[model samples]
Target chain A: MRKREPRVILSFPATVDAMSMESYSAAHGVPGRLIPLPTAISAGCGMCWCAPITDREAVERAARDAGLRVSGVHEMML
Target chain B: MIYLDNAATTLHKPPQVIEAVAEAMRSSGNPARGAHGSSLQASRTVYGARAKIAALFHCPRPDHVVFTSNVTEALNTAINGLIRPGDHVITTDLEHNSVLRPLYRLAAERDVALDFVPADRRGNLDYAMFSQLMRPNTRAIVCTHASNLTGNLVDLRQVSAAARAGGALLIVDAAQTAGCLPIDMEALGIDVLCFTGHKGLMGPQGTGGLCVRAGVEIAPLKVGGTGVQSYSPTQPAEYPTRLEAGTLNAHGIAGLSAAVDYLNEIGIPAIHEKETALMRRFLRGVRDIPGVTVYGDFSGDRAAIVALNIRDYDSGEVSDALAQDYGIATRPGAHCAPRMHRALGTEQQGAVRFSFSWYNTEAETDQAIRAVRELAEE
Candidate 1:
């Protein structure tokens, strides 16, 4: 198993929102990749944007500019 | 054969659309169902298509675009999800059965009241009737942007004004006009815009969807397996996920995405101009032909369609003759527009319909005109 580390997870209510976030991030150099919604997070059963904890601010800013339908933001250990 | 029945479904598609579908079949996995590269690729392709459709129709939110199997499914979703029991709805005689049947079922099963804005013998709607048909309990005004049978474009601005004045939602079925015409849902005051990707959009047959306005809420027709809220008994109450359930047609959507790009590159106005020109040419040739009677008003903006009957002959016989004798293809009979046919007073004879697409050439148009002339003479 990999060693545990802190990660910033952004959750969306729908898969389309997460995909939008991914698209916006790719276009604007936001730092994140989509991962399956971590079971620890109770938002929804769809994909969520996961990034390094240090890049949380940048990711949040990108999502705001993109007007993505993000449901929740969480920081957790992986 | 020179295929002219484009309103039914475009017989020719851009090569990019074909290639995109082939590529998706080779590479894509189930979208939003997994985190693997293939699944993500499928997800991205589907999302890309949604964004393209949203932009093309001027839908405010990309996430609000929900994919369905075809215009029939899209219309079903919009009609069934929004209209409630005892709600007063206004449609038009120009609507295809996709709009009529659902509203009919609602009238039968849900106690909904429906009134249709009548069309004249020329297939032109009396736009003033839109407001007159409105009731205090009116929930929506559902109609087509253009008639599939006659090719007459409805005056949506007038319809939108009526809907707004009556405080009712305007749901437009863009089956005949979507990719062939530029539609700004916001500008047109459309609450829900239903479109099929195959006909004017020149995509795979299985692709279509509805674009809902931000604040509009539609109860889903089918609910299960959205891949979100898996444990919840209720469907996720989000824009798209609220309506979309089960696996999506990602491959078809991939093709639709490419088709949109192709349309963008060519520009919609240019395509409309070419198609309208072909339609006018065909009209000029056949309108003066003896024993020929044509349907629809050609004096205003319309789709590239011409419906005509030759010398009291059955429309099926004329269409079959066009195919077997002239090597030309056209649609015949009811066209799922029983009301439109009745309005034109051709309910018994039906009509031979020739619809044009961007892929059709002047030579093909002239050939179709010649075929119709010979058939009328016979």
Candidate 2:
């Protein structure tokens, strides 16, 4: 088994929103990548923006600045 | 063959569009279905297309862009989804059957009341009738940006103003105008702009969509898997996901993305200028021919299309002569615009429609004009 670490996950209502989050992050140098929406967040099958716990503030700021419709921000160990 | 049936579908597409479609077919997977590389690639391509389409139409929100199989589907989605029972809908006689049929069905099945702004013999819409037709319960004004048969451009500014004053949603069918006309949906205050990729956009036939204004909540026409919200019984109440229920035509959308890129590179105004110039060249040559009677008002800005007939000859016969002897392709018959044909008094004889595109040159236009002149002389 791999070691677990604290992470931040940004979820969105739609795939387009998640795609927008991914695009904004790539363009603006935000530290995150798209991952499968954590089942615990919701039972929905979608993608979410997952970032390191240390960069949670940066992620939140980017989401707000980009005017992204983020549904939830969760902290968990992965 | 000299293909002049561009109002039906653009025969000449950007090389990038073809390559993108081919590449996508080889590599893409079901978008939003998984986090795999192929799925992600498809998702990215689709989102890229959505963003590009939103920008092209000047729609404020990219997420509001919803992909349908074609503009017909998009229009159906908009009309059938947003309109409620007993809602009063306004349309124009210049609309293609795509718009007319849906409204007709709703009137038949849902008790929706429909009013039409009339067209003149020259195919010009009576802008004043929009205000005259306004009702207290007017739910929407659905109109085409241009007539597919006569090519007369609808003044969205006038229509949008009437729609706004009446507090009705303005849904435009841009089948003949998108990517060929300068459309700023945001500036035009269009509530929903439905477009097809195959015609003016110069993309594949199966790809087209609608750009919804931020607050317009159009219910889904078809409800199924959206690849997201799989656990929910109801389709998620998101703009695109709400309208887009099934797996999208990702391959065609990739091509559409490239098509938009090409349009941006060349600029739509430049292409429009070229096409209209060709259209004018053809009009000048053929309009003066003896026994030729042209349809539509050409005194103002219009699409690069000219519909005419040689004397009382059947439009199909003339079109056949142009095709067989001259090798020039044009559309004949009613062109699926029965109301416009009736207005033009061509319901019996129909009309031959020659539409130009950015790829058409002066030489081709001249040849088409010569063919029409000779046909008229016969």
Candidate 3:
């Protein structure tokens, strides 16, 4: 099996806000997949976008340009 | 059978709406939770519905629209979220139970000050009084765009202006007018709009929502799994998601989306013209019935509902006769609008309401009028 690596997850205040980030990222071909908030993360909403830990800066920059209000960002091993 | 209780729900949906619901059920999954094809498809269908609703209501962004099971839930969310303890709110006598009960609950439980601007016996609003009733602490001005019981219309633009002058949020219950009549959210400056898809929107039951303006922030009424953020103790604080929680009625939204598409193709003004014309026909045909009494201002601007009663019969009896003898379905007994009935002095005898829809025909109109006339004669 491939070795599991730690990834970056960005949580938003609302599901729609997270989805907006997903939408913007896809249009710009940024790296991230919206997923159920990782249990390792202590956020309130049910969804967050996960990207390779290396893609943190670009993912966040994309979320910012897209006007998404990220509640928190976490790095955790899957 | 003739269905005249459209104020409750429109029974006949445009064929496309029916197909869309089935199509969604067949292929879609939880939207936004995953990047899988099914999830993306569901997401698109929901977004498409939101976009169409935004266009119809003149909402600036599709994301501002939040889906709920029905308008009642939307109203509850808006009322519960916006009016906190010590907040003052202004509503009206023409409100349905959906608006009234929620405000009433907030008043009792949260220590909110509630005042209702009384309407005239004909269901005409005292628009100027809305300004007079605003307190320094007023947080919301909530009212219905049209009275569900009498089909009387409120000039929402005027109400919006009053709310703005007081720096209060204007929340409109567009349950009866959303898809049937044109609403320009920007022009009207509505802070929150609550609507049901099953009524004039021509969608299936169990689909409705609220549209929030860009700057107005409301607390979430309920919090649960949003299929996104699983870790927070508090609800997510975003426009639609801040308001919408749990699994969305995606299948119903699929129908609602298709329904909005149908409404767009037909045009709201055209639909309004057709429904009200039929109502006027029924009115004119039955106007001479000796024992009959009608409610509502027959002013040009009106909803597709007509409320009335025969002299000797209870509103329920009249409605029962219409349904049993004439095969005409109507709503009777206060319409969950007890305050409006009290205002109209129909407190003891509730009114029978005959509401129309686009699919109804001139033939059905005549039959309803004739039935009322025959009942009057008997």
Candidate that scores best on DockQ: 2
Error of 2 at B153 (Å): 0.7
In lDDT terms, which candidate is top? 1
| lDDT (tens digit, per residue) of candidate 2 on B211-248 | 99998989889999987878888998987889888898
Q: Chain B, candidate 1: TM?
A: 0.99
Docking level of model 2: medium
Candidate 2 residue-wise lDDT, A1-78, digit = tens: 769889999988889988888899999999989989888998878899889999999999999998888889999997
Interface RMSD of each: 1.9, 1.1, 3.5
Chain B TM-score by candidate, in order shown:
0.99, 0.99, 0.98
Cα lDDT tens digits, model 1, B14-105, are: 99999999999999999988778999999999999999999999999999999999999999999999999999999999989999999999
Ranking by lDDT: 1, 2, 3
Reference interface contacts recovered per candidate: 0.73, 0.78, 0.57
Compared with the true structure, all predictions reach lDDT values of: 0.94, 0.93, 0.87
lDDT of 3 by residue, B343-370 (tens): 9999889989999999999999999998
Question: Worst 10-residue stretch by lDDT in candidate 2 chain B?
Answer: B369-378
DockQ of each: 0.68, 0.79, 0.38
